[model samples]
Target: MSLYGGMNTAQGSNSCLCDLRSDTMTAPDGAMRAAMAAAVVGDDVYGEDPTVTVLESRLATLLDKEAAVFMPTGTQSNLASLMAHCGRGDEIIVGDPYHIYCDEAAGASVLGGISMNAIATQANGAVSPADVTAAIKVDDPHYARSRLLCLENTVGGQVIPLDDMRAAARVAWDAGLFVHLDGARFFNAITALGCEAIELANYADSISICMSKGLGAPVGSVLVGSSALIMQARRNRKILGGSMRQAGVLAAAALHALDHNLPDLERDHANACALATALTEMGAGDIQLGSNMLFFTPRDKNPDALRIHMADAGIRIGGQSPAIRMVLHRDVTDDGLDATITAFQSYFTKE
Candidate 1:
């Protein structure tokens, strides 16, 4: 009765549908659906959704934060946290390749009227602490106030170690700037680091944890921080059109995910490592496995061909151009991985 097995059988293709596109593709399992159906409901806009309240409380406790607010997506959670912590004309230091900088539609600037100062990230997805120190703005009427330092772990599937995060946080704190973490995959990093989520959360004034990523919830992310910050974030969420009424149904699934799915992430990580090893052996570009994300660049610059070939084989992957990235999730299995390996080998062998 696991929801993990299904294949696209309409075509003549024998390939099992192994969705490695993103963690967003995962469907709610039976337990998740059941939890949703049976969930106690209340108006979350009025701060009364019992399920959501439980989820927030649980996440806050897990992260050792004073409070938590549930939001529609990781982007919203991160933006709301940033909006809460920073003011207009404020600048936030972030890595050049971070989701906020490269993705996210520049909400920090457009909506919050904040400026982003990009710092170079090392190959390990960590910025130099010295760079953070140097980026802090001098108090001047002409210069934008550097109010916050934002960090992303598992950046583009590259995990930054705890020491790097601590050093950066220390630099930001010494500069009197608030620190925020776009921890969409904080759980994955925690599992990978063999540390409690708080170990990372402690360094940042706010941390955004995604329920829908490795946790396999159908939707939502949690932003955890001090109670005052969460109260402010709730207002920002409302402003951003994220306030939901009677959202406990979704919160129930998230609760189910936290309880049942977190431990299974190790399997996903293992599968990623296995896939990386296989792809590297098959002469694919360096396969870097970080938690559940496997970023593999091809030896040649033919990402389009690889994408098309995989699509034909019914194995969905993401990314194009210079490099192709693959993510392993609970929906993918050891058997499905074999099929993916076969598909890749078949595609490359003929080329």
Candidate 2:
């Protein structure tokens, strides 16, 4: 793709710097490409794609879900999940700054007519159960029906505590609302918690797991839930025009990621910790470290200068946000970390 489209042309950017932008920046290596080439393809719209079928089933078993469906992107997977769980004019309660709210361009509202009620998240990224209880609308036509509770894991790089999730899910479930987990960084959270995937997945009725991020797949996300819910999601996928014809090519890379890249997640987390320590020692401003992500503001408070400095040093960090984020993934090598640290050293005048 890059050869034809020039999407990933070195242009000095890929050759020189480490990209601390996002985990989604990973590119498929030769082995993953080989797997994609070797995949047995079929029309998935008719449910005949064996590779897609295997990938979905593999994820379902991993999270102990009854079924799973592959989607082109996490946003589509999440949007379809919302549509599957809620009817028109229904409400979804989620944490503020969560992907479903701040990102994804409000597809649930724009496309599905589903409304969102966002609760301010505490420092650790867990919504207060008391706040969730208050956010539930009373049974009245005056308010959109509160139908689902959406939560995210790896909130700010730390796993949301299991007890907090249980408390909040209980509140939503007791109120007759379904639960959905946006686990775009699902494996990162599980790896950080050192718990079985089912332990975290058990909190939600449906789960969206993205393989493109951190897991090192070039593309693909899987939504897992009960058979009936997945059936509904499949219908919604068709409605959303996400139904694919020969997606096994993408699924094959995802399967390879699950097999080869997942075990490397903890290494990414370790790299994050190491980077955080180096930056903190250098007095990098306001550092927030989590599993495989670090958010920091340079002490000079000039992200523009810092970004340029790192770019010159051959390290690509994130945007000009007040607290810039740097993500560590399987594609980020030790040399990349070293270059990033050296760039920061020059920025901080420590060297």
By lDDT, the best candidate is 2
lDDT by residue (tens digit), candidate 2, 1-351:
221122353544357558777888888989999999999999998899999999999999999989999999999999999999999999999999799998889999999999999999988998888999999999998999999999999876867988988999999999999999999999999998888999999999999999999988888999999999999999999899859899999999999998888889989999999999998898778898989998888887887777767877877777746778888988898889998888888878852
Please list the C-alpha lDDT of all candidates, in the order they appear.
0.86, 0.89
Determine the backbone clash count of candidate 2: 1
Which residue pairs collide, candidate 2? Answer: 17-314
Q: In terms of TM-score, which candidate is strongest?
A: 2
lDDT by residue (171-214, candidate 1, tens digit) is 99998999999999888888888888878888899999888987
Q: Which ten residues in a row have the lowest lDDT in candidate 2?
A: 1-10
Q: Candidates' TM-scores?
A: 0.94, 0.95
lDDT of 2 at 101: 94
Angstrom error of the Cα, residue 295, model 2: value is 0.6
